[model samples]
Structure formats: C-alpha cells, structure tokens
Target: MKLFNSLLLVLIIVLNFMFAEPSLADPPKITKSPDYVEVTKSLDILQGQLAATKSGQARSETLSAEDLQKKIDELSFQKYALEKGINWGQCRNETDKTIAVYGPKPKKPKTPYDNTLYFLGAGQATPTNWDCQGIYLPNDTKLTSLNTDPNQQLEGAIAIKIFKGTQLIAKNDPETGALELNISPSKFFKSGEINWYIPNVSERNIAFRVPDVPLGGEEETD
Candidate 1:
C-alpha cells in the first residue's frame, strides 16, 4: 500500500508539470493609434492560431506546428515595432457598441479631414505601438464606419473655432490654462467623457452650427 501511494504521488507531480499552462500575457501598452490597433489585432489572431495548433485543435489541420510558429514570430516582430516602449495615451472602447475615432487634423489642410478614423468595436483597446496625440470622440454630427467619402464626412463636423477649437474638445474657462480636457488610457463613458456639445460659442465665424444632439439617429450613434 505504501509503495502504491508513493508511486501515485510521483505520477501526480509529473502530470502537473507536464500539463501546466503558461500565465496569460499582459495587454500591449502602446498608443491607441490606427497602426497600433491593426497590428495588435493581427498579432492576436496569429498567436491564437499557433496556440490552437499546439493543442491539436482544428487549426492544427490547416497549419503545421512549424508553419504556425513562423507566422507568429513574424507578427510578433511587427507588434514590437509598433510598441512605443511605454504605456501612455491608451484608450479603450468601453461601450457595448462600436464608436468612431479621429486623430488631430493635419497642420495643413491639403486633404479634407476624414472626420472618422475607424470604428472601434466593443471591449477593444488601443495598442502600444505608435505615439498617440489623443483621440477625439464625437457626440454630434457623427460619422460612422460606413462613411468613406472625405468630402461628405465634414457635414456638421466640428467647426474650426477661436476658443474651444471645436466640439467634444472645449475647455471650461475657454482659455489656455484649464483642466477641462480629459486624459487617455481611460474608459470612455465610464466616468465622464468629454465629447462634442455643439453650442453657439464654438465658431460663429463658420456661420453655421449643428445641434448638440444631432437630428438624425447617430446618438457615436457611442
């Protein structure tokens, strides 16, 4: 009986070591830029494929272990290149629905502002690939994932203004030093989001303004 018990204990120890899974990896901590988002997503898919292959899952039939490993290595390199080496300016789409994103308008207007970058699906986060200037979330005059035309994107878009500069991006005092703007690496709509609220004070020179809540059903339509 004692000999049998000893043998069983050894087997359990060996099995535990053999079957133990690795700890989960931390999320990438890059700026939440477009390139960063795309690369991280591709990397995730590649890694998942490789994992499935190792586990003898359905992906195993399509990808041999060697091929899958090679693909993962290549994508990992792309992910590293996008890493900013620090986790700053990170943002996540905390909503249940997709929301459109925007970057700063280029200093020059050689091309029209797209007004919308990409629609971040729910629970997705900005990766730590490129530097983030800051993401603009619109509350009104919404563009969507479907609107591809640049000219059409600007309709009811944030106006170029003197004090606040535009909607969803204003200061409380409307002056140089104000604590109105929020920081990133944050949960949108979680605490208090600083989205667009179209008011007359935004840009009178533009000679037009959209409603604070747009007439249509675009509610980010976040």
Candidate 2:
C-alpha cells in the first residue's frame, strides 16, 4: 500500500511539470506580410529609376520588359496606398484660398525740414493768416513776389536766402529781375536756403518754402 502511494505522488509531480512547461508550438508572430516586403522593394527600385532618369541614364529602349513591369507594379501599389489613405480618413484637406497676409503698413519716408521752415510774407497783409509769405533762405537773399498759384508758382525752386556768419556767399540779385533761378546745392548754407530779396515792405514774397510737414503733401500758407 505504501509503495503504491509513493508512485502516485511521483506521477502527480511529473504531470504538474509537464503542464508548467511552455508550449513548443508558437502563436502567430507579428510579421510584415510578403506583399509589404515586395511593395517596399518596389519603392526602392522606383526611386532608383527616377534618379537614373534625372541623371539622363534611363531610356525606354534600354529598359527590359521585366524592369518596365516592375515600375508599373510599383505605381499600382502607390495608387493603392493613396486609396487606402482616403478610405481610412488619413488624407488631408486641400485649401486654395489665398489669405492676404498684410504686414504692418510700411512707414512713410521722412523729410529734412519737416517742421523747420516757415512762410513770413503773408504776416504783413493777413496778420495771423499769411499768403505769399517771404521764406528766409540760408543764402542771405529774400524772396519777394513768391506766388502760390498752382499753375504758375515755382514748385521746388528756391526763392530766397538766409545767411549765417559773414554772408560770404553773395545774395541773389533780384535787380537782375528774378531770372530763371537755378537753385544749386549749397555747402555754406546750414540747410540749403534759396535766397531772394523783397523790394516792397507792404507785400511778402512766397519763396519756395519748405513745409512744416515736408515729406508727403504740399504745404499750405494761410
């Protein structure tokens, strides 16, 4: 009876060990499919062919029938990939609407005499409000008969002069009678003043005056 009991105990141990050992037959491995490998190789070959074409080495005549078939197969696979992407909601939306991305408005160019030059002639006639005023030029000459008529006024022509130090630069001769004055760039003048003289005290001359705000619009003399 004891012998039979020992044998039974040994058999139970053996059965437990057998059951504990891992199964020799494995579960299906997570592996890439054969089709996937073929597709990957096809893509590599396609890229090579394209490179060859770019390098001027690929020719339709040179390619074997098998090579052309391989290229066609790769194209078909790519098309399938695209189709799959669309069906799986992996494709992105295409938008062609142009958004006018406006940057900060470009800044305006600045002028030299933006607020420095003034009209002095109209002060005599209009008192506070002046028209055809004498603008002091840096060249030591006064401008008289300065007109603001849009059609006749000398636009951009220097009509008077203001001088510093000894007026080493001779002032313009109005007695020469306001000849077609060609204003030149002056090195002596602090800020290139156009010079002319007013013979009459009652009326002020409007020399080409720099605007208080000179950069953009025309200056208005009251």
Write one digit per residue (lDDT tens) for candidate 1, span 1-222.
Answer: 999999999999999877877356455445465546765676687788878777867566556878767766765664565573532334344544443344333334333333323334445554442222344333232223213431233333332211111112222223322213332111223112233222222122221322121112233211
Q: Which candidate should be chosen as best, given TM-score against the real structure?
A: 1
Q: Model 1: runs farther than 4 Å from truth?
A: 1-29, 60-62, 84-222
Residue 113 displacement in candidate 2 (angstroms): 97
| Residue range with the least summed lDDT across 10 consecutive positions in model 1 | 159-168
Write candidate 2's Cα lDDT for 109-167 as tens digits.
33333222333221111122112212333222233333222124233323332111111
Write down the TM-score of every candidate: 0.26, 0.18
